[model samples]
Target chain A: MYDYSSRPSRLPLPVDERMASADIDLGQRKSIYRSLQELRQFEKRAHDLFLQNLVKGTTHLSLGMEAVAAGFGAAMRPDDYTFATYRGHAHALARGMEMGPAMAELLGRSNGVLGGKGGSMHLTDVSRGMMGSYAIIGAHLCIANGAAWSAQMRGSGQVTVCFFGDGTTNIGAFHEALNMAKVWQLPVVFVCENNLYMEYTPIDLITAVPHPAADRAASYGLESVIVDGNDPDAVYLAAGKAIGRAREGGGPALIEATTYRTGGHSRADPAKYRPLEEVEAWAQRDPIPMYHARLLGLGVAEGELSSIERDVAADVDAATEFAKAGEEPTGEALLTEVYADGSSRWRN
Target chain B: MAELTYREAVAAGIAQEMRRDPSLVMLGEDVAAAGGVFKTTVGLLDEFGPDRVRDTPISEQAILGAAMGASMTGVPVIAEIMFSDFLAVCWDMIANEIAKSRYMTDGQVSFPLVIRTANGGAARFGAQHSQSVENWAMMIPGLKVVAPSTPADTVALMAAAVRDPDPVIFFEHKSLFATKGEVPEVEVVGRLGEASIVREGSDATVAALALMVPRALEAADRLQQEEGISVEVIDVRSLVPLDTKTLLASVEKTSRLFTVEENPRLCGWGAELISIVGEEAFWNLDGPLVRITTPHIPLPAAASLEDLAIPSVDRIYETVKSSLR
Candidate 1:
């Protein structure tokens, strides 16, 4: 079992830990690392907005999961459909869903994505090809499968990236989706953010084989890779390559990211199921600090980094006020949106 | 008038439409080589070939999801769900996604997917297989739910479902398929969301849909002889784009309205019809609207229990009596 807490925790995220320690071309890696820092700062604001959106609803912030989104999101195009699970605010922010609207959506304001109907779990901005996030365990897999199949049929180079937690693999739709994606050579990247434990059940107990969960892909004759989820550059490089391969009709790939959720799955969860020593170990491997240290070693200025952090904090604070000030949707808006033309037979 | 079974008419209607519209495709579990579980897609695979006739894995969500995606383009896709009971699996994709897509997209995006599935109970297919989910589909606006009772009605309605520019759920009764009636072919295009007056009468109007149409017709005949009460039967082919004009006009003339449906009385088609009439033509109604339907219970698995779940001609006649009283 991988210990989550023994690892170091801080900003810039550690690219030195585990498999992410492998170096990339200095120039290219630096550019990705720089963009990642910017995205991190942007997401900090998103996290605050996410909290405000959850009017009693639970919001899972991607404080550690930012690397996976920032990295992969940088590599993908706006046309690409990004489907995600509940812990999706980071993914949404990376996909360009504004921090304010995203927060408004979370707060149940009508100005939010989905007009406040979806809250955090069902956030969708199809205009951005952010297909939508599903709250159901493993349900978005089917939606992505269908979306990818559609893209293949249309000859659209756009691929779909389906993000889910480690627990989603246990659901039947996971394998079914992969098999369908394989059979049709659909453009879809199945990203498994193996944040150690799925909610509270440790990966070892529920996962049967273990982390990476990449081994399961071979049964479908697809290549599977395990990446350092905490390392934004690593996640971005892997996602970029996999998404490119999928766009070229290279079929689907299962990329399992080995990382840890610093917090419990949802707001209310204490995560008592996780062993304290293990949590401390994974925390030591916190992606932010390790990456920030790497940037320092690379000679990036400490002053510039501090400035970026301040900017991010200001952005988040502004978004918080924006979301809070947004008006709630009237009760009329509820049934009004049920249909476009208001032609419900009952309404007649 | 040519005699045709509801199944034969449905198959003929789909075949004629496919022949007319080359872009139309039909795919489902057991719908290809197996000719559908009820043979509704019989000879369709041979006629349309592999491209048009496809057999999908038994994934309900996959089937509906694919159809929704395919319909985004000009390709008209008809997805058959073997049984309406299986709709529980993909209800989200259907209710939330498909039904809300067109309106949410500001009508720029139109999904012309027709989901064909066998619904209602007659065989001892148990709780898992037997369900009259027409009322369930009727709840959505962007999506239209069509039910064709007799062979003629089936032919007219299936073509209409295929031609509709919006998503349509075509529910075919497994029990009614073997029943035959006269059918006509008029260049394969039929008016969707239109009500058909199966039997015209003066005393009372019995508005029914799907399998309930025949039950209403039989009950009307029985009551005509036994109690000297004339019964008018109107088969409501489409549930969502309801032909309210025709339905209200029938009740306006007949004065009395009684609805018969296979679904349970609470929140079913019967309730919807009663509510619609109550809102539109409440004062025009000669008597209070009555609904004859199955009892609210998990469909019975046993033969007797299964038989007792849906409304029959006997129950329809009883409701007619109550409405007259």
Candidate 2:
């Protein structure tokens, strides 16, 4: 009975109105706010390091897209699995990974989370269940399905949450994973951070449908849910429903979060392609300022919010110093971990 | 000892490992109720049931991706890609994500999984279905490659590949599926990177793999009878963790080396072996190391063309007889 053509618009309600009606307790609210603050500080420091040529390779920053990661990270369980894309610093920090190791990894230091082998695009820490930050687009969705299938087979009751860009919706693996996940009723939640652009081009120009991910949900027998990516409360509520359903064996769900990246796609991109008016409009809706104002309006003291911001800044500064003091990887590091035996030797 | 076909040994090998390891699972298209397109996995669904033995859709990416994901997160898996050539459909997952994941993750995750596929030609399936592409996997650093010739080696190697705590690409030859050989009716586990000396001779070392092993043995028999050439035929089973010690010892004893390969002439597995022998056993060689391989071209579907395309018994005989002269 679901109508594909005449589907009603599901853009999230006004942020202040949703915050007033949100059922989240004060402690949870403070945690979400803190995560958002951490994400902002970490990314800004990364950008600064890149400018100073301390970070190597390329980095994809999730500047204005923190709510989607923060909201889901707060809602997910400690044992649950998280699969993220290259723009995954936010997701990694949100999952409670230490910022020092993550920053060291970006700097290609020996004390990195992956010992400087993975760099920025391939950050992985299995201990905290931040499975991996895959560089290849559309590949991790299918991998997420595998993790979910394992959970289902083991009767672990664990849910896997996979995050990707809106650009990934058009790729082959995305469709393949979606169809297979639905067919098997795997316990996974696919979140598409639709920033309205795929790299330099607007996604609407290349894609056939208006809502790339949510529109294709019905084809795979999934319910379409679009959330406000800038509002933590809205994202948290939508994520809770989807995660809860998946945990209770209700199959998989697809959530398309509409948001914008305040900066370019990567460090090299100047972002001159975006119009000035569009950029200004999106900057006005930045998640941090919106969440900060909402917290003050909800009878939380302004002093408390400022203190949280100060603490996050200090943490980012300490992490930067730690990364700077770390040594560069050398010698045996180049020829290790190619196989399970901890050596790269192919023959005797 | 019992005689079993190569395909039956595949099923027995998988069933044996699945019986021992409760965490192992299998997934692929037509792998469950259909018993696989090539029928290499018959009777598995009945023994293991639906949960363990799964029939997946025709999505190669999903099959490999799911297998990698599950293996990294605790459960070991054995996924089928139907045909070895179909690996191209999901090469990104196999080559990029699955192969390099452990190395890139700095050993944080391990993929203890097996990707078994029906490989090579002799049945006129054309170029799309028939390719001895073990070299493609050998070039990748993180994968372990295994291709067995006889029924016993199939079961033993399958056991090794399944138990190993790394990603292994198990290539089961389509041409050898119906061939039967003596298989011991007991628990048999073989080590990776070990070659079997199926024949012994003092004149020259002829290294072959998969279907070419049988052809090389037949050619060696013909050479000894008519041409008076004594050829040592070594089945170079595992390609990645290559058994170089056995190969080097054979080359040193024989003082001459020749490789029989079914892949294209350019950059085949034989090329790597020849390069190694040329480097390490340079003084041990009596003549130039020669590789008898199929020419670099798409395999034709016709019987005559296919026979000529793959290295045959006659081709192997003539190449060795003429090279030694």
Candidate 3:
């Protein structure tokens, strides 16, 4: 039902929102938009690199998912741990893993995250506390729960955020982890980016229940919120509330951010299998342009947006060049990382 | 030297370690109140209090998972997974998380964690709980796997496991719990990469672990008396960082070798022993080193069948005598 071309026309741009705030005059909103553009552009490069590196692989680009990462990413401090799913490109980019190395990782270059070994799904940057992205669906929730419990035990005031899709809710591990989190009052933020599709299947056809994320939260007696994920500002505001409540020992919070995967499930599909009308409708509510229009509405020149775009493009270009040029890791690397000390037992 | 049962020696090892280092803690089902299913932790709660000696929920995953967490945060924790067979529930936490944490973290983290579990089918605990899982430890990376055959070896190796900056699976044979022996009063940490030579001979090398160590020694004693075949018994206390030097050195002296283990033969811990013998001491081997193990079947509950299931003294001696021929 939403108009596709004029999605940004629906609301004030993020730049405009900065102007509209009652008394605050900080350029945080503009900073968020600028930082987000960096995330999307780099991720786009990484996606292409991933496609090139992997033989017959699937890669999910977070083109419409940037705002979610930026919002929650900027809101939290560094020591907090984050567990993300396969659709975690933006989250990694947002968490400050240098663009070049991460891009190299996608390209399977020696310069990548695991010296270009883990590829996209296994990208890990421990300095950022982005515990390695999990390949198994819903299993990461238990790891995140354990990480949060560790934080609670350490008195580090460290918060844990677990990012998964609507499909993860159907898993038994997800339910068990959520129940444990609520019962133990672990300071965890369960971020459900309900992008309306699990992979190819629509949320409705796949799940038995409605409001698949938030409805399940109440069963465990944990507080939850439903937010407009398309709007980064809304996500940031909601995350701020939820993260604050969790850090204060208010148990755990389940945040359902309603959005859509504008791109098809993976690199392969043209998404021709999807009903065209439904796809068109979701595109109309696309997050990028609406925020752009909002920015222009607040007396921001078109040149400012272009400048941000230019910077992002340049960043992505440099990352791609860097990844492409990185030296190939030696065959010895395969022998390495099997253990901390790299025991020579397997070696001849 | 203070006299104690084999169970009491284990308790003393835990108590001494806890007293020696403030960071050590123990968690198992009923470890605090009932003092372990084997009563190995008896009077520990009274001495150490509730926090240090914990009675965890009947969740094996959580028990091992918490120990991994505590270890990561700079404590050396020893957790008991009630029965070695129950370890199947938390195998992921052990193999993937605890065992792999150090290596996966690129040496950023050190998991100085020890897991103590009792294994073997000597008591007829049935197929579900009686299987020897030394092979499971062999499968996991970043873990030092050891099974102590004697009370002295158990005390020493456990102490070494706690002190080592790696995840160590300390397996104690259930049948060996009440079996008393001369354990040293002041424990000396045994070298991990060295195989202890229990008995010396010339004809063959007998390698074993846990209760099988004594059984192999017993088999060697019998082989000498019956056939005048002197077998050198080598206790392979740890399997992961296998003492290839000492083992091969003994194998070099005695061209023939036999392995006796309580576990099943298929992809079993005995396979690794065979492989090692095939590789390192290949030219030295007069013939194939035979592996004496339980037949590949679920251990039966009947006592007579259970005795047949495990490698007996005569069985090991027969295997060794046959290998010599």
Candidate 4:
């Protein structure tokens, strides 16, 4: 078990020193902390549900990567689009997807976001600008670039943020998309959530560069930045700048947020591939507890923090109940919606 | 009506659509300042400017992926893959992302994407450049496969493809680029899933696609004049949402079914049509279904070998004449 108390005595805070010196206000600071807690707690519940065999298919969790979601989500406008990888529940939640529909989707319920057709790997909330998630590594990069290109063509000023892992940077599509983005001056921010592990293998084993953003960004001519992903304030500050620049037609930027998954790659694996000390160290630096510590240091009351936690707990419980009660889709429903105009008339 | 070559009709159609809808963007290698390789998109950069008519790196995956992404955001994208043979390089984006987006999103998303690529073996472009992989696209459920045979149909169908709420694989034939035909002066949009009777006859029904449509027509004229066999030619414009109604009607009248395509004989576009006709109008046929296609060999670079590979007018004429017996 990890400690949740936000005490300065935890010594050498796992986060960057900049978090302590950042100019974030008390209210905004509290909100960021609360968002991380909510995401963390929600993900924990989802993992529990997966263990209980309620989640129909396997799900990739962002257990310790909540700050990246909370920070990036808070910075972007609701109208701004985001394309994320399969470990995308936090992104969808942060981008304003309702917990009921999101959880229902995991349970493969009829009321699920994608009507249960797309389970955990393919969560989409178009209205809130969570364009969709892709399971294929590096596939969504060009798609996000295209969305940004669309924004540029229409002069919408909507910045498209694409979230992928460190492993995805090595994929061919990633390089192609970044190159196209730079050449076209697309208004997009490519966020590589450098979680160290691409599934079982460490990213360094496969990736050619020391840092994905450092080497690849220069090649693509994209304005690049690196941030402590565990620190929400740092991510918010860096991501906000990148997104702002993109919205203002400064072209694309690469923000490599270095963090760790702190969980198994998927539902089945015990993650025997990783070292015990590495896992334990990542656990201690869990974003939720780290954020809690910062909130306490910033003068947040223990009771106030407890109240936010209680509300989040209640919300997640309600979501579970709603998902359990969701109806199972019929075979007839599957035939529908294959085509927009329902031109897949043969199925009918 | 104005006389326009098949290539001109495609360009005119795209330019007309781009003018009407500002969100329609074109992206491909050499499509912008240099115009397209075949010059089908000539003067588009001058008219629409670089942004709408843009050039892309030699990245088919990016071209398709970006086009799909753009389509999801309400911008209709027409991405030219240079040639249908190269579609294999970007098959994942087409088969996985573009084809499955709407279905996987449970209708929450729609990809108004048009993938325009030149199909068929002609001009000794060899195995790499020349291939009629229309059947590969036809097998994918979500895609709308269209191969226009005439300039008018090319202009009309190109309009429909751009406006479609789904992904459309528009296969343009390299051989028919300079083939002249009359196109409407006013803008016309060909309806998807509709077939055109290019040459009407009574003895046998020859359902053809792409480059084979002209050959089937030539064969029909020759058969009528020489052999006194009235051959009905059906231009299978849309392969995915196939115009089975017109095909069945034609087959019912002619009482014989023949499919002409430049795709390989084994498991080609003809194979699917044969099955469909066998299932639906099998009892109505006067004889067995005939499929004329390129031999199942990689198109050789040599002209003599290529001639032996691709189906010719002589082959179609002889087949129809022999089938009548």
Query: Residue A169 lDDT in model 1?
Result: 82
TM-score, per-candidate, Cα-based: 0.86, 0.98, 0.87, 0.96
lDDT of 1 by residue, A193-233 (tens): 88867776666566667553597888778886998888776
lDDT of 3 by residue, B1-325 (tens): 5556678778877887888887577877889999888888898899988768877666666566557655664556888987899888777777776665544434545678889998877888989889899998888767878887777777778788888777888887888889887777785566565678999988888888888888888888888998999989998888877877877788899987788888898988778877877987799978887888999999999999989999999898778777676
The TM-score measured for candidate 4 stands at: 0.96
Tell me how each candidate scores on DockQ against the true complex: 0.33, 0.88, 0.24, 0.60
- Candidate 3 residue pairs that clash: A4-A284, A8-A290, A12-A294, A13-A294, A13-A295, A105-A112, B149-B210
- CA displacement after TM-score superposition, residue A109 of candidate 4 (Å): 0.7
Q: Model 3: runs farther than 4 Å from truth? A: A1-26, A51-58, A202-208, A264-273, A297-302, A344-348, B9-11, B14-29, B32-34, B41-79, B95-110, B181-188
Q: Is the docking of candidate 1 incorrect, acceptable, medium or high quality?
A: acceptable
Q: Candidate 1 residues B43-75, lDDT tens each?
A: 888888976888877777767766765576446
Estimate, for each residue in A151-254, the C-alpha lDDT of model 4 and write its tens digit. 99888999999999988888899999999999989999999898877787777767788787656888887656778888898999988899999999899999
lDDT, candidate 3, residue B120? Answer: 78
Candidate 2 is scored at a TM of 0.98
Candidate 1 vs candidate 4: which has greater lDDT? 4
The candidate that wins on DockQ is 2
lDDT per residue, candidate 2, B44-77, as tens digits? Answer: 9999999999999889999999999999999999
Q: Is candidate 2 or candidate 3 better by TM-score?
A: 2
Q: Rank the candidates by DockQ, best first.
A: 2, 4, 1, 3
Give chain A TM for each model in order: 0.87, 0.95, 0.89, 0.93
